[model samples]
Structures are given as structure tokens and as C-alpha cells.
Target: MSIFEYAPAPESRDIVDIKPSYGLFVNGEWTDGKGEAFKTINPATEETLAEVACATDADVDAAVAAARAAYDKVWGPMPGRERAKYLYRIARIIQERGRELAVLESLDNGKPIRESRDVDIPLVAAHFFYYAGWADKLGYAGLGPNPRPLGVAGQVIPWNFPLLMLAWKIAPALACGNTVVLKPAETTPLTALLFAEICRQADLPPGVVNILTGAGETGAALVNHPDVNKVAFTGSTEVGRRIAESVAGTRKKLTLELGGKAANIVFDDAAIDQAVEGVVNGIFFNQGHVCCAGSRLLLQESVAEDFLARLRRRMGTLRVGDPLDKNTDVGAINSAEQLERIRALSEIGEAEGGERYTAPCELPERGFWFAPTIFTGVSQSHRIAREEIFGPVLSVLTFRTPEEAVAKANNTPYGLSAGVWTEKGSRILWMADRLRAGVVWANTFNKFDPTSPFGGYKESGYGREGGRHGLEAYLDV
Candidate 1:
């Protein structure tokens, strides 16, 4: 053990006052759900955070009916500038209460405070800000002279980045003059509920945004609701597939942002030091719970040994512990079930003869935790390399040439995102051209901007979110 140990510097939990219980936000008020309530716990300490109401089928219907009514009576008839003002107010309120939201998000979602504060919350505000400006500019967006809003958008967001995903789904829908009935993930509903409060603070019209909290059943109810004219989802590929099938043959406009096993390719001629950082960010950022996380690393064989040595050294310096700590790097796994899934896949990797290397960090004993892990001898056939682990695990494979790198990178069924690190601009452009991913990072990895449109191709799901393209999802083009 090292003699110089850093003391814990935890952020004050008093910054956020979590309520004992939360209710569904429907038609501008908190109301009891038709189903039993569920408890959400902090995955970092296994501490119960709050009890949240779970929406039942009737609750979903009521929420949808509210949204449809708002769309037809208030939101739909309102001028675009008025709608823009509400969105701008919401964005400003998000910025004002950012610290509270960030801390609450870390507690509820078990992500590092660094991420919740700097990345998630800020981006949440930015998404609203970005789309807020577009509220009145739909005509010049190249869609048509007059692009009309679709009625009542039903949005289902996953738990990985709860508030951010909600912003991604809700911002564009509202900007296009559509009302929203959003169902947040069961495990991470607090932030969305808090966002409901933000909606209230903005004086957003009643029923413009309704938040439903529940498991998959509630999401199904919202998605299949007859009054909903649009559906947007961000979650596992399996769920996305099911949603696609369920909404098939219907006239509902749909956009699904699904799973990814993205590739971060490093060439021998690249800046190895910068590339190493990019690789770490690609796989381990957010505890590798990102939908477009670069879980697969493709390295040129010539520099594999050197790169691995540097990567291992850097991984050793990561701090894994309480999410509220200001200095913590990696945080707890989102839940026990997710941790078990990660462990099972990692065991499969070891059994298949892949060499496993985990970051040397002490995890808290109380809650769900998994160390940062990497499989060096991974092959294309290995289950860890093929499936979406959705945890802090990386599967490394080597390639001899650029062609082979692209081949291995594009081999997977997912094509949500990809990254390439090289000094040669021509090679970067060449690689980007051939890669089928929706977002390709040339030198950086996992950098997101609200101005950039994000989504996937192939089995990774279809349609785009963010930028002007996001408007098309909720508008009659």
C-alpha cells in the first residue's frame, strides 16, 4: 500500500433535499400512480434514496390524454415564439439549479460527481438551450416551408444518464410544438422527477410535460397509448427492437437510440500518449454505462505492448469509491443486476482464454461495485467482444493494417459510435468514410455536443437525436 493516502472529500449531501416519496407529474401536478410504489436506492452505498410511484396502464392513459389535450388546446395552438420562451425559461432554470440537480443525479444514478456536474447536467441544459432556439425556426431547417408538430410524443428513457436522456427526448419534442408523456427508468427516476419540478418552476403550461415513473410495463403502456402520435426511446437494443415491433404498422413517428459496442481504433503512427487517454475515456467513462461506449479497442499490433503498458499504468491511478467525493474517478455500478451481468460476461471472457486485467482500486463494501477491467487476448468470437457488456470492461484486439482495423471495428452488429486515433488526417478521413457508425470521433473519444446529431445505424437502431435532425423526428416533414 502507498504511504500517502488522500483523505475523502465528499460533497455535502445537504445540497439536495430528497423527498421521502415522489409521485408521478401529470398535468402540472403530482399525483399517485395506479400501481404500487417502488424504492430507488443509491448503488454506491445501498442506501434507500426515495420511494417513487410506478405508473400503471391507467396512469399511462391519463398522462397521454393530458398530453394530447395540452397539444390540441394549448401547446399546439401557441405561437412558436411563445413555445421558445418556455423552453428558454426551462433551460435557464436548469442552469440556476444545476448544483442541486447534479448532486441528486450522482446520488440517484451512482455516477461520479465529476460527470454529473460537468457533463450530464450542463448538457441537459444545453440540449434544452439548443432546441429552444429552434422552436421558431422550423421553417428554415430545410424540412419544408411549414413543418407541423406531431401530437403527444411518448418518450421512454433509460437509466444510464437519466436526466440527460430525458432532455434529449423532451427538448426536441417540445421545441417542435409537441407535448410529451415521458416515462423515466425505474432505477433512476429522482432526477426526472426533479426535472418535473423544474418544469413547474418554468411555469410551463399544464400537461405540456408529464413524467411517468415505472418499469418496462409502464413504458409499454405509454408507447402503445392510442393518443400518442410520436415515440422516442433510448435504451438496450433488445428493448428498442421490441418497441420497434410494437409500434410497427402504426402511424406513430418513432426514433430509437439503442445499444452499441463501439470500436476505438489506434494506429501505430498515432500519438500514443493522447491515444491512451482517449482509449480510457472511451471505455471507462461513466463506468462504461454509455450506449455508445467504445467497449472494443482495436490496436495496431506494432504498438500493442507499449500501449497496454501505458494504459495499465494510468488505470492504476483511477480513484474508485463514493460518487459524492469530488476526487473520485470511477463510481459504483448502477445496480446489482447490472453488476452481475458484467461479472458473468467477464467470467465468460476469462473462460474463453482472454487475459483479464482489472484496475487496482478499493471498492466500497456496501454497494454494487466493479473495478475497471480489460481483456487483452480478446478475439472477434469472444462473447465479451461481441455482446454489449454495458459496464466498465474493455475487450482489446490487435490489427496489422488499417483495412483489418476497419474490418474488425465494423464487424459488430452495432454501429452507434466509433473513434479513431492517428496523426495522418487523410487516414482519419479515410477511416471515417468507411465506418458505419452514426458519430465518429477522429482523435477524441466520448465527447458530446448538443449541436451534433446522435443516433445509430444497422441493428443499433435508426433515426437521429440532437441538432436540427432531432426536430424531424417529432415534426411532419
Candidate 2:
């Protein structure tokens, strides 16, 4: 749960050790890059945490070459059981150093300390443990008698959930025996660098997992590189389109997990308080940085009033402030650019005829923060209802029947995820079948497990990221 009620107890940042500047991790070694660097700030206080190196095109070439060498000689030829040993070691190391990773994640990514501690870091370790069990058992995974690695994988992840996204992309690739050349988002590169340290702690072979830090140009170089065999990206739909075009005629196995404007349908029969909590957590989690966030609330006309009243009350109870505070339900926005995007979209939400109701909260003066916001009297055609806001904003629309609810929910081009709240099991099943999303959660929101496959269709991008399906992206079937 993103929203919490507790006394103020801050997680100490002293556990983390950040260098003044960081370099690229190629061949399990560090390179200072071409001396071009950018500062990654603590979004809570707008304090410059450290200077991160910007990887050049040649840096991408070196990383890819190292990954290829590892795949060709060391990592690929290693026995599956031996690879499993490394994964298990990495997972254990993550659990041991969980506090340090959690603190650095909150400092770098602007999520609350409790969330970074409880939710993301645990999930990151879980992904590794789950995939480790599948390492030596690929033959029985229902793919084929034998499935081979895809060689060098070029992975680019967004800044929303840094360590968790790394786990989602890297763990599966390594389990399937594919070496990776990963490029973490520029805004949040610290955890990925630390993860490179974890690989060293596990005694993972040189060049088996290389991390190159930079912005979009570095990502483009990796995506369009000649020797890279697979491309996996989790970011905006526009960038996903560009990656798809660049690899259109190439042999690179591509997978993209992009944006979403998910709909949360709440019927009159759904428990009001329960549905209220679900709705609030749906959009406000991770400052709405999630790609499958339930931003659109489709309510039954008969219960829309009561549901909305409870939702407003729930929103009022939320505490918004510093990322390090235990009491702050919503933390700082991820970055200044993301803050501007949220503000611009919220303004458009007001202009497009949606009645706005912002939760009362005293935001911190130094950092980027957006209070919990709701829009009632919203039309399906409004820009607020149709677009992905990626902030702490909710758009509510009323519908007469299940058919109308499904119709409104399925109207978006994104088919990443959706939510349904109803007491009737048959109705839940019916709605789940027609929601047109990759994941449909009933009675719960923002719940994830490593065993379940997660991805989207159409503009949300294709190919799954967890379970057995995730293995396909890094393997040759």
C-alpha cells in the first residue's frame, strides 16, 4: 500500500555511500567516460546527490562488445546450475544490502522510504529468486526440448522504479543465459551502479552484466547497435515506437513495456470503503509513475456519488511530503521535468471541463511535489480522461451498466492493465475477460508477483516480463 498512517521515523541515508562521480561498468570494470557528466539530485530536497557519467556512443560499443564476449565464451557456456548459483548469490546479497539499496532508491527516485523499503526492494530480490529456480529447468518450461540464449541483450529502463525494473529486465536475461548491456535512466542511475557492485559481490564473471549510464542517446546507440541480438525497453510509447522502427528490419528480438491510461471500474455492489482504498492507491502509488496505473475511475451511476465521497475522504487522509519521512503517504515528484509534465496535464484537465478537487497538503518548499488530485464530472472525451497523466491525479466517469463500463474502460489505445471492483464473482470474471488489458486486478490494485506474467498490447507495447513468458524475450525458442 502506497498511502500509510504512522509516526514520523526517517530512514537514515547514512547506509549509502555515494561517490562524487560515477563511471560506466564495462567488463566488470569502471571507465570514467569522455569526462562528460550529469548530476543526479535528491528529488526531495533538490540536492545534488552525485555526478553520473554520460556514456558516449563508443562506450555503448564497448559495453556491447563486452556483453558479446561474455555471451560467446564465459556466461553462455556456463552450466545452468552454475548460473543458478550466481543468481541465488545475487538474490541473497540484495536481501543483505536491502537497507542501503532502499535508502539510495528513495534519495534518487523520490519514492517514500517505507515504500522503497517494503515494496520495491523486496520485489527486486523476489524476481531474482524466482528466476533462479527456473535456471536449470528450461527444458520443462514448455518452450521446447531446448531453448538457447539470445546472446547480447540491450536493455533500457525508465526511472520510475530503478532497482525493480533492473531486476525485471536483468534477472530473466541472466537466468536464460543471455548477457546484458543495460543502460539505466539518467535521472536515477545510482542503484544500477550499486547493482553492478552486487554482481561483483556475487563473483559474477567479467562482462556478464555491464551497466552503461546515460540519457536517451546512449539508449539509442544500444538499441541500434549492430552486434546486439535483443532489445528490451520500458519507457514512453513514443520512444518505444522509435526503437521498434530502428530494429524494424533487423534481427534483434524486441520487447517494449510502455505507457498506460488504465481504467478502474467500481460497481455499486463493491464494498465502498474497500473500493475507495483501492482507487486511492491505484493512481497515487509511486506518484503515479507506474505505466499500468489505474488513472481513470469508471463508476456505476447508481453508486458513483457514495464511492466518490469515500474516495475524497480517503484522499484527504493522505499525507504528502518528504521522501524520507515515514508519515508522508506521497513523496516528491521524480524530477523537475516530470513535475512540469504533471502540472501541464493537470491544467489541461481543468480546461477540458473536468471539475478538479485537490487534497489539502502542505508541500515541501525545496523539492518537486504534487498533492493528490481528483477530477469529477469528467467526460470520456476530455483530455484528462483520454491521456496518461502520470501524476497523483484521478479522473472519474460514471457509467450505467457493465457494458458501458467496459466500453469506457476499453476506449484507450493502451491495453496495459485495468481494475474491477465487485462482490459478484461471475461479474468479476466477465469484466476481467473483456477489459482489454494485459493485467486485470479484482479487489486489489498495484499488486504484483514474480510468478505472474506482466506486459501490454497495442500502444502499451508487447511481450511479457515475468514468469515463463519473460524467458522468451531473452531466449531463442
Candidate 3:
């Protein structure tokens, strides 16, 4: 029976309270961790969900050694068909436990339950299902006769989409016959640990995958470990650069999916209502914690006033509440630290002579929350317009012509994604050709499919995370 079918009944609570501690998964079993310990908070309520083991340098060494052994002994020579079966099993398990996973994700990560349930969990399973099909088909992937695994992979995921990112890393790595030592962000370790249980339930081989939890130090130890043959990182551009510098001259293969400051361009001829909805969804999804959020809004001079008026009215209708609430649209900020970062940046925007407008909404006193903020009259030179403000913050700028729109959109060092809203198909193609972003959405925003290759260009980072392109990241050239 599916776990969702038998999911525990919801109980009334003044506040949601989760357990106190969790163990690390090593050698396919949950075990006591070596380093100091830390606590993960419910960002919505500031309640401690659990204490997580802060992985030490020694712990990273042990995890790496185990992964190396698993590669040589179990996963390395495992036939592609066999690996595919295991991935299929994982997909099944995730679906069976989908609701539980979604609830846990919302509780730990502060994203709305609707997003965790409808988007993250489903796509995570789809990723595994898609990659599973590629396992035995490697011979047909155009990679010349024989392709082999990259050995032990060291993966580090960010806090923004913890479990989904975990799926992205582990699914492709395993499908390609590589063992992994994955370090989940310290604040969002719950779902990853739960995934460890799913692996055990599927009877995956020992050390085929391991989950380690900690802050930056643990991730650094894992990435820099000598035994790891490949390193995959998804986080900030600043940290991505550090990883690139750290691995310089080393033989370790690296693939990074970093930060973005995406542009959502609204033309004068757009379907106004639909465009407004897309704009809201693009920037406010996951509280704008997404790496590819449409943080910069480029409004055509002809429709600037009308678009902003509709956008502000639409923002007012959004429901903000507990992440676990099934009906919630916007949830709490992920952490106190991130909330402070957003506040600081917003203040910088105001001090730099940009106008700030916030939607009028009541916020919970105890939780870390930031009202959805929009800054107009923003110059491209303003810090708010240039930086990747990974929060529910948008900066609006006016463009007199299509040329001006393209110039303003391409002005950033980051080139992750952009949105083009117009009824004319020709304009979309033209704008898409001109915009220097990884993904271009014509009439929509934030649409994803496992078959679609997704990644960024320039300092937003390199390497795709989905489809056949993702396979290249795990293969030895």
C-alpha cells in the first residue's frame, strides 16, 4: 500500500513540532555521526525540528572511503539494466511516500506544501524514471562504443530545493554506475535522510549512496577529498567560484549549477492577465528562493503603468501562511539568516534611490517572513538590480524598445533564464535569439520537464542537470 494512502491523519497543533535528531546514512545504514551536532529549524515557527550531525573532516574521509569501496566492489561493474531497476524502485518508493515527503519538505524547508507536493516530489520521481530509462541505453547515447562511470562522485546541494536537488544528483550518478557521497545542506537534511530510508527499502547495495549533513565546512571537506573522482555543486556563484578555484589543477571533474538573476520581460502586446499571473508565479515561486527566479522585470515603456497596477493587485490575492497548509501560496522565508540578507538588500535598494513598494499583508510574528517587495525606477547600476536577490523581491525597469529590453536583460554577469510574455510567436523567437540566458519561456514561466536540459551560462554556472545532457556530467570523457 502507498504510504500516502495510509498517511497519518493531520493533528491540530498550535505549532508543528518535529523530532529532535537524525543519524547519517553510511554504508547503506543509518549510523551515529562523528563531528559536532547542529539543529535544523522550522523557518516558519523558529522551532527546532531536529538535531543533525555536523560532519567532520574525518567523517568525510570515512564516507569517501566507503563510496570508493562501493564503486569498486558493487556499483562499478553493475550492469546498466540492474542500475535502472534500482532507480525504478526508488521512483516507486518516492511516489508511495509522496505526501509524507512533501509534508516533511515543507516542514523543514519552508516552501508551500502545494509546491513540494505538486512540483518537487513529482519531478523528483520523474527525474529518476527518466534517468532510469537511460541506464541500459548508454550504448545508444552517441558517446562512441564504450562509456564508463566516473567512479566516486562528491555532491553538494543547496538549501533551496534540498530533496529535489538530492534526486537530481543521486539519480543520474547511480544510473551511470557511479557511487556518491552527498552532503545535504544542514538546515534541510530531513528529506534527504528520509530518502536514505527509501534506498534501504529498495535494498540498494551498501555505500552505493550516502547522505552526510553539515554546513559549509562539511561540504568543502567532501568536495576537496582526494578519493572523490568527480565533484557536483549547486549553490551560490560566490561558493561555486571557490570550488572551481579549489579544484584547479586537480583531475576531479566538476559540474556546477549556480545562481541566477532572471529577467521577466512584458511587452506592450502581451495578454495582460496571463502575463501578470506568469510574472507572479515566476518571481514568487518558492518565495523566490529559486536559483532561476525572475527577479528582474523589464516592462515596455508603453505598458509600464498598466502592468505594474495589475501586478500589485494580483500580488494582494496571494495567500501566505504555514508551509504545511495545503492551500498556502507563499510560505515563510527559509531561515533567519536569509531573511536578514533580503532585508539588507532591500534597504540597499532604497538607499540607492530606488522606490520600494511592498504588498500590504500581515506576517506571523514568530516566523521569518518578508513581504513581497517590488522596486521601480531602478537603474541597471543599482545593487538591487545587479545582485541575485534570492528572495521574493523584484526590480522593475522600463525599456523603450526591443533592443533596449535585450540590452538590459543581457547586461548581467548571470545568464540562467528569462521570460518573454507576448501573444506574437515571432517576437518570442526573436527575443529568445537575442537573450543570453540558458532557458527562455515564451508565454509561461517556471515550466520544467525531465526531458528538458536545464542549466545556466556564464557566472550563473555551467553543466546541465536534466535529460541526456545530464548524463555527460557523470561519464568519463
lDDT of each: 0.93, 0.93, 0.90
Give the top-scoring candidate (TM-score).
1
- Write the residue-wise lDDT of candidate 1 on 113-226 in tens digits: 989999999999999999989999999999999999989999999989999999998999999999999998999999999999999999999999999999999999989987
Whichever of 1 and 2 has more TM-score, that candidate is: 1
Please give the range of 10 consecutive residues that has the lowest summed lDDT in model 2. Answer: 1-10
Residue-by-residue lDDT tens digits, candidate 3, 72-121: 99899999999999999999999998888888888889998889989999
For model 3 the TM-score comes to: 0.96
Candidate 2 per-residue lDDT, tens place, 69-151, comes to 99999999998999999999999999999999999999999999889999999999999999999999998888989999989
Give TM per candidate.
0.99, 0.98, 0.96
- Model 2 lDDT vs. the true structure? 0.93
Give RMSD (Å) of candidate 1 vs. truth. Answer: 1.1
Off by over 4 Å in 2: 1-7
